[model samples]
Target: MSEVITGGCLCGAVRYRCTAAPNNVGLCQCERCQRQSGSAFLMATVFARDAVEFERGELKVFAAFDDDGQGLYRHFCPTCGSAVMITLDRYPEIRSIMGGTLDDKSWLKPTYSLWTSSGQPWLVLPPGIRLHPDYPDGAVA
Candidate 1:
């Protein structure tokens, strides 16, 4: 089995573990993502919904729709207001963990970047990472 990945909210009020390897690790620079993260972009690591197991505390969720009108749910720590995870109605089988919430982020390497059209002009990405003006042509997320 792959090594278990563990993470939690900034306040330590919510904790979780992932047993499966990530399906995708990407950066999102959409306007909504920028606002949600309060940064240039959000680093998200995706895995199967069943792979993530919450070990402690409850998450407060904010539900909204994307620019395309797809349902989006943002889960966070109510105590510290740290975004922890997100779920999409269009991809119910998948869950995305906010990379910053992970206890160990040394292994987190974003392979793709989305919404480059809305990405911050001053931001620079590492070489060879795929860039998409919007969601990748065949990507489900």
Candidate 2:
């Protein structure tokens, strides 16, 4: 069996577990991601939708649409307002966990970065990782 991954919100109001390994892990520097994260970028760990289970608390969802009219749902802890997860209409089968929320982050190694066009001018990307101005061909945002 795959090792389970666990994480939660800042106030401990929300917790979750992933039953399988992540499908992908990447950084997003899109304007929406930067604004939502209050940072230069958002590190997202992608997993199969069915693999994630909310173990405690409830998440308040904020839904927004992309320029293409696709849905982008941001799920956060209401108590602490910590962005915990994201779901996209463009990739219905995946759930993206906020990498900063992971209880154990020592294992994370992002392989690519998306929306580099919007990335901060002073921020230097990791060495040798794939970089995309937008979403990679057929990959999640």
Candidate 3:
């Protein structure tokens, strides 16, 4: 079992706790991730949906579709505009937390890259790290 990880949004409008370790922590090079994160890619940490819980405010969700046109929920704090969490329809059992929103991002690092083939030009991922042409193995657990 992984240690419990706790974090909240920029303005504390959204708070969350995870009782188990993330199944995956990685960068997403998909176009939607780039656009939503406003960066080269989105740094995300995946956990079981059942392992996460909100302590206070609720997240406002904006549903997005992946390249395959599948639903992906982008969750954020309506009051702070901070990107907090996500849930992909393609991988229903997983919940991904935006790593940047963590109080201490020092411990969070991508173990791999997702959607590398769709990655933006000029975005160079770390050498030798696993790059999933699509979703990585065990992303939903």
lDDT of 1 at 60: 93
lDDT-better candidate, 1 vs 2: 2
List TM-score per model, in order: 0.94, 0.95, 0.85
Off by over 4 Å in 1: 67-69
Model 3 C-alpha lDDT per residue in residues 31-64, reported as the tens digit of each score = 7888888888888888888988889898889996
**Highest lDDT against the true fold, candidate:** 2
Global lDDT scores for all candidate models: 0.91, 0.93, 0.82
Clashing residue pairs found in predicted model 1: none
Candidate 3's displacement at residue 31, Å, is: 0.8
Clashing pairs in 2: none
Please provide, for model 2 over 6-118, each residue's C-alpha lDDT reduced to its tens digit, 9 standing for 90 to 100: 99999998999999999888999999999999999999999999999999999999999978999999999999999999999999999999999999998888899999999
The TM-score measured for candidate 3 stands at 0.85
Q: If both were scored by TM-score, which would come out higher, candidate 1 or candidate 3?
A: 1
Model 3, 138: alpha-carbon shift in Å?
7.2
In model 3, state the lDDT of residue 50.
96
- Any runs in candidate 2 off by more than 4 Å, and if so which? none
